[model samples]
Target: MPRLKAEDAERREAAGHGPDFLEALARGLAVLQAFGPERRQMTLAETARVVDLPRATVRRALHTLVTLGHVESDGRLFRLTPRVLRLASGYLGANGLSAILQPRCERLSAEVGAPCSAAVLDGGDIVFIAYGQPARLLNLTTMVGLRLPAFCTALGRVLLAGLPEAEMDAVLAQHPPFAVTPQTELDPLRIRKRIAKARSDGFALVDQEAEQGFRSLAVPLRRHDGRVVAALNIGMHSERGTATVLRDSYLPLLRAQATDLAPQLL
Candidate 1:
């Protein structure tokens, strides 16, 4: 197959997609993501290099972003402002799934005596929107806006398993491999095999990949139309339960809660 030119990809993507869907939104998001924890303030040249866009394009995007209040800049440096939070907040406020699933997640956590969370796929990471824990001690310290690599987390795998094969391939291709932990799978073939297993099993069990002692299991939450909107997960210490324990004991509870909450998602 031939690679698509930027203009061709944009045309194909826009033909049937929403009016708001466009390559410009993606490029703008890339610009915003260029400013992260380590590179909070970036010069125009640095932003262009990081986002892999032309300096002129990056500058115009930055100017537009600043005008929209999503970014702020001094004469020489640009950084994301708190106004960016409104974009995320708007998503949470608009999605009824978080509110509908929070109670079920809490109940599941109480029943399993572990921490339960709900996350939606945001680009290549899973974003936590709602969570409940037995105690704050066992928590992963993840907040509503925290992002984690999709390939290493159970919540991520479950969500990824629901995506179209081509889309999943494109996403994984971007970060072919990165070692988040010793147990992380960096091999594409192995990752594909695991995703296939998750697709067949209807759940994903990630063992100590995100952190040394952390293990998590997740099931996809589907909307009324049967589209997967998010994932629900229960995470615990490695010592707390074996992988077998997670599969045999906790998975059923998680599946039950997901089934119960599915009706509320749409």
Candidate 2:
């Protein structure tokens, strides 16, 4: 596949006429964007290739970012430093969606005696934004900001079901809906049918799809305008209950919390 180049050129052209827009600053941001969970450490040439810029240009940007303490290098590979987290901190800290949803997640967790989370679909994944868990629940391997596959996760299915049919088809086509577990729906048509069921039912119950021993129940979290902006879900240990118990017993609790969280999305 071609390297990710579409956004870099677009951002530069959009910045062309802005009086205060800095090309160096934009390139520096691009260099930072080149790094992610999969590419945490990259050499200058690799960064240049990923950002679709010349090696010298990326090197210069990396040097300036190193001076600013946003990036660090040990003479081989460059990696972002903790200072870069400040940029994300400002956005997540802003009073609104997360602030409102997290408390509801906490209350929902307490009421159900389990872990609960709210996530929004981004690209082919769902990024966790808010969470809550009971004390007795074992520590989880996941945290806020973690991204999970959209096709296999209950949260992702509920969010995907909210999209218009054409938009949903487009997304499924791009992503291929690859199976994450043996039970996952690998066929795009089958996955579309599953999403349709979720749309009609107003929720999704994924049974051992994302993981072997876990299942999930999820519902759409809508805005005041009745647009689903995110999904709220409960992860369960499959051994604890059957799918019928998961839906009939615990699904209502999730739906109720989802109702409370919907209006806050505005």
Candidate 3:
């Protein structure tokens, strides 16, 4: 086993306590997550810097991952392999929410003449679990596992509103809002108020906050126990008119779908 540096060990201990914490497993996962679209391939030294771990530690993790077929390496450069998708597949298969929602999302997208998606909050981001698009080309393309900022998207607002106040506050504190677009509200107080409004209104409408020329509306999807587990949203071009028109036209549809699917989820 490669020895973790003193500072790295201290940071890991602080982040994950208890004797049951497997430091090696945590380090491996961290190393895996360090790879992203922007960083498709990297050298051992580059990966070590990104993960803030010693080169030896990262090298061992990469070796293990390569042996397991989750990573590919060519002497000097390392990259994740398609086999890594099995990890995400396992979660989706076990949860089954994506499977149940995809067909409904497609139907909704066709009816609305726009894109429809379902997402769940993951850390400071919202991960799209299911998505559907109209036959016509749209500026935005969403797919399963696409991650977006939770502070700026209607889907994110609704999902964040579903969290308890304390939990929501903790998340906001941890990931203070950043500007995804000029329309995105960077003020934490205003963002909190927006989330609060979503909680009370049962739906959220965002105009051009997530992307230029794009607008979206979202509503919470609850489980059988009335606990919100995810959010459903529709995205369209900003030319669709003002926020009021979006709310009036799409809010009811979103709410209806959410309600219809609530009994099926859990």
* Residue-level lDDT tens digits of model 1 in 217-261: 999999888899999999888897798887888888888887887
Ranking by lDDT: 3, 1, 2
**Winner by TM-score:** 3
Query: What are the models' TM-scores?
Result: 0.79, 0.82, 0.92
- Candidate 3 regions exceeding 4 Å error are 1-13, 138-142
Q: Write one digit per residue (lDDT tens) for candidate 2, span 46-120.
A: 999999989999999999989999999999899999898788667679837778878888888888877789888
lDDT winner, 2 or 3: 3
lDDT of each: 0.86, 0.84, 0.89
Best by lDDT: 3
lDDT of 3 by residue, 60-121 (tens): 99999999999998899999999999998998888779899889999999998888999999
For candidate 1, give the lDDT.
0.86
- Measure candidate 2: CA RMSD: 4.8
Better of 1 and 2 by lDDT: 1
After aligning candidate 2 to the native by TM-score, how far in Å is the CA of 196 from where it should be?
A: 0.7
